[model samples]
Target: MTLPEAPRGRPRDTRAHQAILTATAELVAEAGYAATSIGAVAARAGTGKDTIYRRWSGKAELVYEAVFTETESGPVPDTGSLTGDLTALVEALVQEFSAPAAAAALPGLLADFAANPGLRSRIRGHFLAPARTRLAEVFERAVRRGEADSAVPVDLVLDTLAGAVFFHVGLVGEPAGPRLAGQLAGLVGRGIEAR
Candidate 1:
């Protein structure tokens, strides 16, 4: 007798997904991506290596998902004013980069992406574009409110603001406190100002 096909697209167990992501993040933080093997992750996650392989083809995909998952939520702070909103956004971005877990994983992830152009493309498509789109929405709102110029290039503006925050967190290695937030806000505000 022919057996009926198993149910397609079975709902994933949220707990398992979270456990894998947690295990992957901790491994990357402790050993860096290059050193984190699927076996190690499986052991840490209390699952079989086959389970991880079933979910992801390999380690890079798993690590990519782990790092990007941490920042899956869009960054859009509504502080009622453009300055307040931008300041909060930058501060949050800095916090993400500065977080020990993120800081440890991101550098390795970026290096891997550099080695593999395809992975870089995946990161841009999955992570960077969504972030840029969200920032563009904020810029659009500011333009509509007459707080920013409609003619400004949204990508350039976003890159400048985000780059400044990344520079501080990635390079300076210092806490991005209120003072840095205010400076970034001032720079972005000036760029947004109507000519």
Candidate 2:
């Protein structure tokens, strides 16, 4: 027997979208990647499996959007000086890496990255590329202002700063806050600034 189709004229439920994403991130954080499932997301979100499937094809698409939605990079503001720009950049770093989605999903995502080249590629393209482009803009501006040496390796500096925070978060379990931020800014800034 054929099931009756519902009427087509209807608005998309943005609340359901948000609920699904929130539930996905929380689950990733709580259960790790291997354990987070589409069925679980649907249940936790208080929505039907059909609703989730209608929007997202499966787990990867849903989880990726959940982690990347709030973290996409935009222009980092010119804080007037290189140090200020650097500080702002690091603050953005803290915000991105410390976000609930990233925090919960990273452990599993990194593992997946090692084994799944396609997943790694998607992450690099969608998330890392945008953030790197913005950081490069900040450093390029600093160079134009003559605040830092044009010869300064922006990639290394950025990697160092961001990697340090990642290490502290993943290994030491230290909080990424203003104090740690200032210290990082000072260390990297002192090294990068023209002396």
Candidate 3:
């Protein structure tokens, strides 16, 4: 069933949106990205190809939304300490990346990110930018609390989290857990603490 046209964007059909997203994630995870095409996604979602195209510009856009927006969890955490916040954030990321579909989709997607600057930019804009901003805020609070040095670069925090998550889930194929996440958080905290 086609949704009645909306003025600015696709029809406000949440079910269709979610279905399309889930289908996209599943397809990419099941087949490589090269095999996950718009027509396939449309058929899998039981929606018209037009519906998928109406919402996203192309394959990268569709997959970016499916992987980032539809799956992101644990919104900006406020755990009082930088270590606590980082641990929570890292744990959430582990959960997100290690999910069945994401677990399957990520290895291929991560490879794509290395090769496609445009894909990286779109995903950074859609998801990572906000996450980085929240992390910056958490770092700021830590500095105020004397947990981190005032001079520590926020980039270090960002990179540390990224590295830890990727190293465990992407390279080693280990599920992310509180212990590992906590260790990473503690490492970031001590490494950047004011001398």
Q: lDDT of each model, Cα atoms only?
A: 0.74, 0.75, 0.76
Question: In model 3, where do residues sit more than 4 Å from their true spots?
Answer: 1-13, 68-74, 121-127
**lDDT-best of 2 and 3:** 3
**Mind giving the per-residue lDDT tens digits that candidate 3 earns over 1-195?**
555565544554677888999899889878867788899999999999998888887777777668755424446778887778887877776766676666666666677777888777775456477677878888888888887888877766777788778778877888665588788878877788877
* Clash count of each predicted structure: 0, 0, 0
Give me the runs in candidate 2 sitting further than 4 Å from their true place: 1-20, 42-65, 68-75, 99-101, 121-123
**Which of the two, 1 or 3, has more lDDT?**
3
Q: Looking at candidate 3, what is the lDDT of residue 3?
A: 54
TM-score of each: 0.78, 0.71, 0.77
lDDT at residue 150 of model 2 (Cα atoms):
77
Return the top candidate by TM-score: 1
- Could you give candidate 1's per-residue lDDT for residues 68-184 as a string of tens digits? 546537546777777887777777677667766667776677677789877767765665676677677777788888888988887787678767877878766777776888788
Q: Candidate 2, residues 1-195: lDDT per residue as tens digits?
A: 222463342323667888999899899878877889999999999999999999986677688678754544355768787777777777766776677667777767667667877766776565466666777887788777776777887678867887887888655667776687778877887787665
User: Candidate 3 at 61: error in angstroms?
Assistant: 3.6
